[model samples]
Every structure is written in structure tokens, then in C-alpha cells.
Target: MYWTNYHGHSNYCDGTHLLEEYIKCAISQNVKAYGFSSHAPLPFLTNWAMPYEHLVLYFKEISELKQKYAGKIQIYTGLEQDYVADFNLIHKEWIDLPQLDYIVGSVHFVDRFEDGRYWEIDNTTEVFKEGLQGIFNGDVSQAIQRYYALTREMVQEQKPPIVGHLDKIKIHNRHEHFFDESASWYQEAIEQTLQTIAQSNAIVEINTRGVYKKKSKETYPSHWIIKRMYELDIPVTINSDAHHPEEVTREFITTAQVLKDIGYKTLRVLWNDQWQDFSFDEKGMDLK
Candidate 1:
């Protein structure tokens, strides 16, 4: 049994270690396929994203690593691109570069700040509160709604192969401090977003970043949400969202079991140069 993870990071962005370190760790963990998904380069002020100047170097190094590790593991290139639609910030077209194997479209920046910086919902809880008070005037419902709205908009516009970390805005709602996840409005927002995803060819990734990082007790979409996705017949892929070598498959053991319990018999995986559904167990996917 071997793991298949595509959403990961490296020193090019916010992640630790060089690109090759992650590959070595993946091999040690019995991983058969992996992808380098550094945070896509941004046009505006942000410290975490890869610099626009680094794109060529990132691609070149990955190309070299792909050839070096060809027979040992399946390596692919992808980026976690954020969908920004703030007119307040000057718009710049995304730079064209060598083709990527896939893209994990995500909504990290909900909206821009008054000074023109973007509000990252995935950042420190302090930043979230600041944005909530300053932007939404403390209206959690409105804030959550806007997040989902942007998510749906990104899906419609980009139609990326993978929709990353659905419902990640809930990361700050721990202990129900802000609002109830079971609230009618919250579920409605999720339902509406799922409807949009259902119509598209995009696959929803069951992200384990929140779980292993201790940010949440459940995966990005949570268990009930994955069940909802199953009802809609939305395909899913399990991703570690690894930022470190040791975290490559951090919570996959339990996540896979939870998925199976939720009636997911197969997972979407990129294998043999194609994304296909394959049978899997808690240990790992059956690539045989």
C-alpha cells in the first residue's frame, strides 16, 4: 500500500525544507506519487507566496528532480492558486509559464483591507478577528457567506481540477465561539457551494491540514460534509497539505477510514499519468 498525495509545499513558499527533502520523505513513507504545490506567485503584497521571479527557477528545479526520481515515484507539478477579485487592488494578469499537471484552485484571500492588503482567513486567529471587526463589522454570518461566495466564484471562473480545502473558513470557529456549524445559514452556504462544485468537473480534495496541524478536529470539509459530497456524487482526493517532510501523510490513516465509513469506496488519484478512481483502504490506495 502506497500513499498518493498531490497538495504539498516547499521552501519556495511558506513550507520548510528544499524540494528534494519532501521527495525523500515521501519515498520513506511508501508514497508512490506526489506533487509539488507551492503557493502560486502573487502580484500584490504578501510574504508567503512564491515571488514572481522564482517561477522559472521553481519549474526548472522540479523538472530536474522529476528526471532524478522518475522510476522511484510519480512526480507532478501543481500550484495552489488563490482567486482574487478585489477591484481595490490593482489587477494584474497571471503570468504565463510552462504548463502544470494540475491546479488546486483555492480562496485564501477573502477581500482586501482598507490599506490594500488582502485578508487571509487561513492566517493567525488575530488576523481573522481584525478582518471580521474591520470589514464585516463583526457580522460572522456575512463574513462566512462572502467566503463561500468567493469560493463559488473561483470555481466558476477557474474550474480547476481540484477545489482546495472546502469550508476552511471554519478553522477559526472552534468551540462554537463565533457561531454554530449546524446553523441553517452555515449549512445553506455549504450546500450552495456544493451545488456549484457538483456541476463542475472539479474534484474536491479532503484536506487534512487542519487536522494534523491541530487547527481542527476534522478534515477541511469535516465528516458530515464529506457525506453530503457523497450524496452529490462528488469525487474526492485525500491530500495531506504537507508543509513539512514528516507531515506528508500525517492524518491519512484515520482520514481514509472516515472516508470509507462515509461510503466512499474509491478515491481520485493521479497515477500512470492520469487521474483515475482507485480502491483504497486505511493503509493507502491500491494502485495495483
Candidate 2:
């Protein structure tokens, strides 16, 4: 059995270690294929994303690393692209020129503040509450709806190969303080978004970061959503969304078990220069 992780980060963005450090760790973990998906450069100033000035250097370094690590492990270059209404993957000039192996389209910003700052949905609990009051006037349902709406729009319009953290907006709703996942409105939003993703042919990543980070009780697009996904026959991939070297495959065993219990017999992976499904167990995938 061998493992693979496509969502990762390094010092180029808000991540801790250098890019090479993550590669070395993946090799130690026996990862067959590893992808570097640093937070993509945004038009506006943000602390987490790769700076606009470093975009050229980021690509150059990854290209060099790919060659240096060839045959030992399969390396892929990608970006966790954010989708705002005005500035998205399609509109980004530099993103179009680069030869990205894959794109993990995501929606981290819901709407802009009155002063024109993009409201970050997953940054911190305080910031989330601020946006809840400022943007939706404490109407948690509307704010959550808008977040899923942005995701649906991205899938329907831009339609990247992968969709990152499908239900990440629920990170702050840990204790059911805002709304219940079983609520009819919440399920409707998720179902509608899943329908859009199914039509777009985008793979949904079952991210484990929330679980390991203690931000949420389950993976993004939680167990219930996974059940719904199984019903819809949506393609699913497992990603750690590691920002630190040691976090490369954290919580993967438990997550795989969860998937198994959900009746998922196969997981999608980018292998042999293409995305394919392979049978898997808690140990790892049967790539052979």
C-alpha cells in the first residue's frame, strides 16, 4: 500500500517549513505522489497567500524540485486557488500562464466588508463573528448560504479539477452554536452545491485538517455529506491540507476508516499523469 497527498503548503505561503522539507517528509512517510498546493496569490494584500511578487520564484522553484526528485517520488505543482466574485482563477493573469498540474479551487472569502476588505471565513472565530455581524447582521443562515453559493458559482463557472474543503465554512460552527447540519436549509445548500460539482465533474477532497486541528468534529463535508456524496456517486479524494511538514498525513488512518464505514471502496488519486480511482483500505491504496 502507498499513500498520496495533493493539498500541502510551505513557507511560500502561511506554512511553516520550506518546500523541500515537506518533500523529504513525504518521502519518509512513503508517499507515492506528493503535490505542493500553496495558497495561491490573490489580487489584494493578504498575509496567508503567496505574495504576488513571489509568484515567479514559486513556480521556478517547484519546477526545479520536480526534476530533482524525479523517479524517487511523483511531484505535482498545484495551487489552492480562492474564488471571489471579481478575482478568481479565470481572471488571474499569471495563473493562466503557468503549467499547473492541478488546481484545487476553494472559497475562503465570502463577501467584502464595507471598507472593501474581503471577509475571510476560516481565519479565526473572532473574524468569523465579525463577518457574521457586519455582512449578514448575525444571520448565520444567510452567511452560510452565501459561502456555499460562492462555491457553487466557482464549480459551475471555473470548474477546477478539484474542489478544496467543500464544507469548510462550518469550521466555526463547532458546537451547533449557529445552525444544525441537519437543518433543511443547510442540507439544501450542500445538496445544491454537490449537484453543481457533479455536473462540473470536479473531485471533492475529504479534508482531515479540521479534525486534527480540533476545529471541527469531523472532516469537511462531514460524514452525513459523505453519505449523500456516496448516493450521488461523486468522485472523492482524501487530502490532509498540511501546512507543516509533520502534518503531511495526519489523521489519514482514521479518515480512511470513516470512508470505509461510509461504504467508499475506492478513492481518487492523481497518478501516472492522470486522475484515477484505486481501491483502498485504512492502510492505504492498492495502487498495483
Candidate number of the best TM-score = 2
User: Relative to the true structure, how large is the alpha-carbon lDDT of every model?
Assistant: 0.88, 0.88
Top-lDDT candidate index: 2
lDDT of 1 at 254: 94
| Model 2 CA RMSD to the hidden true structure, in angstroms | 1.4
How accurate locally is residue 32 in candidate 2, as Cα lDDT from 0 to 100?
84
Query: Per-residue lDDT for 1-288 in model 2, tens only?
Result: 888999999999999998999999998987889998888888788899998788778888988988999888888988988888777544365346556888888899999889999899988889998999998999999999999999998887667788999999888788547788899999999999888887878999999999999999999879999998988889898899999999999998999999999999999999987999999998888774
Q: Which stretches of candidate 1 lie over 4 Å from their true place?
A: 87-96
For all predicted structures, in order, the TM-scores are 0.95, 0.96
- lDDT tens per residue, model 1, 58-170: 88898899899999999998888888765313212342344578888888888877887788998888999999998899999999999999989888877778999998998
